[model samples]
Target: MLAAVFHENGGPEVIRVEEMDAPRPGPAEVRIRVEASSMNHLDLWMRRGLPIEIPMPHIGGSDIVGTVEKCGAGTVRSLLGKRVVVDPSLDYDWYRLARLRGYDGEPFRVIGEHTQGGFAEFAVVPAANVVELPDGFPAETAAAAALAGVTAWRGLMTRGGLRKGDRVLITGASGGVSAMAVQFANEAGAEVFAVTSGSENVRHVRGLGADHVFDRTTTDWGREIHRITNKRGVDLCLDSVGEAIWPQLLRALAVRGRLVSFGATTGPAAKVDIRLLFWRQLSILGSTMGTPAEFRDAMDMVFRGKITPPIHAVLPLHEARRAHEMLEAGEVFGKLVLDPREARP
Candidate 1:
């Protein structure tokens, strides 16, 4: 077996493809022959080194679509030979208790960030994490949808309280999660506003059902949305860009409106105006990945064809370094997939 891994973190160039021993499933786990895996911004963060400890020579990928090749002790035998997509959000005992109590648990950390992930010929996960894929479904598409789709669904519907006829604003609309947020909000009958880095991304974001697309390079999107909505502002705003645009998002929200954020791609520090927060009576909510129920609901819509995330490119596993470069440079509009079967001999 071969895996794309980095012994030490710094940049994309640190990632390399090397022959490695295949992983085996543990009790209650299943081994997946990874067909396709997708990249998330988390990958970039991990590669650049976060504060958490990582296993040396770590493989970083969270969104995985694969076939069950073997089942380990106490695993359900029926899952063997099935094609499935793994929910990258690992669950814990306290998480279930928190969900039952209607609170968000400090979630078990993400797969690739804290555990070995799917950038390999084979990976192991708890069998309970696998979601069966319908026959003939494109594995690459499922892989692309796994993390971003779930994150958007939870951010907008669960945290943002998005509903039909709501006016929604999504910042950094060209990335995977933000693009999915646009489509999901649109399908829910919201009037969707989007912000992108340039004219090229504006066109792409518009194609994803954004009612209006503003180029961040030239437009003050907050003011534009404010004017467009006749000073009422948007009912909801979903932001992933973090510090770079948080202040603007505050100005773009309607009175008592909610802003749900899942990531801080542009660095975490942000300056907030205390007056605007109190005067508007706004809700600024933080969200990470979805709860188990939310994950199921989101993937159900995905597997049923209600939403399909765009795939910017499908590269071989050996090109993982180049893929990371593209993602880090903000050159991709959607998910970049890796086919482990394409690894060199």
Candidate 2:
């Protein structure tokens, strides 16, 4: 097997494709012959190194679409040879209890970040994480949607309490998660407002169902959103770029509004005015990936064709290093995929 392996983290240059032993399934796990894998900002963060050390010589790709080749003991035999999409979220006993009670859980890790992932010919994952792909669904599309789709669904619908006729604002609209957020918010009957960094992305976000798109580079998007909404403000704001845009999100919320933060791509620290929060009766929420149930719900909608996760580009698996470069450069507008089956000529 050949995989994109990084022994030490610093930059994209650290990754290289090399022959490696294929992983085998463990009890209640299955080995997937990876057909496609997609990149997330998480991958970039993992490669650049985080506070917690990952396994040396790591393979990073959380969004995976593949076929079940073998199942280990205690797994159902029927799953063999079935096409599947992995639910990247890993659950622990604490997370299970928290999810059942509808409260925040201890921070959970994802497939690519905490364990070996799918940037290779074969990867092993818990059987429970493998959801069978619907008939005729494209593998590339499924891989692209897995992580971003679940994140958006949980942040907007589950945490933000989005509803019909409500006005929702989605920041970082050009990114994979936000692109999906625009569609999911709109499908929930909300009037979607999107924030993108440049004019080039305005139309892209609009095409994904945003009612209005603001150029973050040119205007005060928060004020623009307020003016466009006639000063009422939006019912919900789904934002991932923290610190740099957190204050603006606060200013854009209506009375009794909800704001869900999924990631802090910029940085997490934010100074807040307690007075505004109380006076407006606003709710500030934090969400990460999602629960198993949430993953299933999100995937059900995706496989049913209710929403589409946009794909920015697809390259051969060996080009994983370049894919990281593109993502780090902020040139990718949506999910970027790697086709493990495409060999260089």
Candidate 3:
């Protein structure tokens, strides 16, 4: 099997397209013949460097859509040949307990981040992570939406407690998660305000159903958002570009507003003002990749075409290195996919 493997993490140049042994299913796991795998910012981070320990000879692709070719011992034999999307979030039981009960911290695991992922023709994941798609569903579509869909759904809806008529502000709106966030908020009957880096992305984010879009390069979006909202501020602010605008995000929020932070592309060290937080009665949430149930809800809307994760491009699996480069360069508007079948020698 051909895979985009990196013996060590450094940069896109570290990725190599080479033949490797196909992975086999382990107990309660299944081997997926990967049809499509999409890129995430997480892939870029894993390729460059992360604090966590990752498997050597790593293959990075958390959003995977494929067919179950084989099932391991004690697995459901009926799953074989089913088209499915892999839930990249791992260790859900511990994750759920840790969140719900505040138990001692459990090791956080994600498919592409902690273990070998789907930048290969074959990948093995726990059967529990595979969500079967309806017949005739396009695998590439599911792959594109997988991780972004889950993350956006959880952060915007689950954690933020988004409601109809709510005013929502989404920062860094050009990325995959924010792209989906715009659509989800729109569909849920909320007014969506998006902030991106340029005019082109501002336009793109608008097409994703953002009611108002701001280009950070030329506009002070925080003041603009407050201005547009008549100084009442938004009910929720879903932001990932932390530190750079964290304080403004808090100020831009309505009293008792919920602000969910899913990522920190701008760096995480924010000089927070305790007064702004308490004075506004704000709720600051830190969300990661969601639970399996959330992943299922995310994919259901995606597969039904009620929500579409925009596809920037589809490249051969061997071009995973180029995908990483494109994403890191901020050239991609939404998800970029890898077609394993097109990984020609």
Using TM-score as the measure, the top candidate is 3
TM-score of model 1 (CA atoms): 0.96
- lDDT by residue (186-228, candidate 2, tens digit) is 8888999999988779988988999999999998888888899
Clashing pairs for model 1 are: none
Check candidate 3 and list the clashing pairs. Answer: none
Candidate 1: tens digits of C-alpha lDDT, residues 1-345: 999999998988899999999988899999999999999998999999998897778998998889999999999899999999998988645555776876665657777778899999999988988999999899999999998999999999988899999999998898999988999999999999999988889999999999999998998777888789999999899998999888888888899989898888888898889899999999999988887778889888888888889899999999999999999899999889999999884
Q: For model 3, how big is the CA root-mean-square deviation?
A: 1.4
- Report how far off residue 156 is in candidate 1 (Å): 0.3
Model 1 lDDT at residue 94:
55
Off by over 4 Å in 3: 99-106
The C-alpha lDDT values of all candidates are 0.90, 0.90, 0.90
Residue 34 of model 2, lDDT score? 92
For model 1, the superposed segments whose C-alpha errors exceed 4 Å read 92-107
How well does candidate 3 score on lDDT at residue 214? 92
lDDT of 1: 0.90
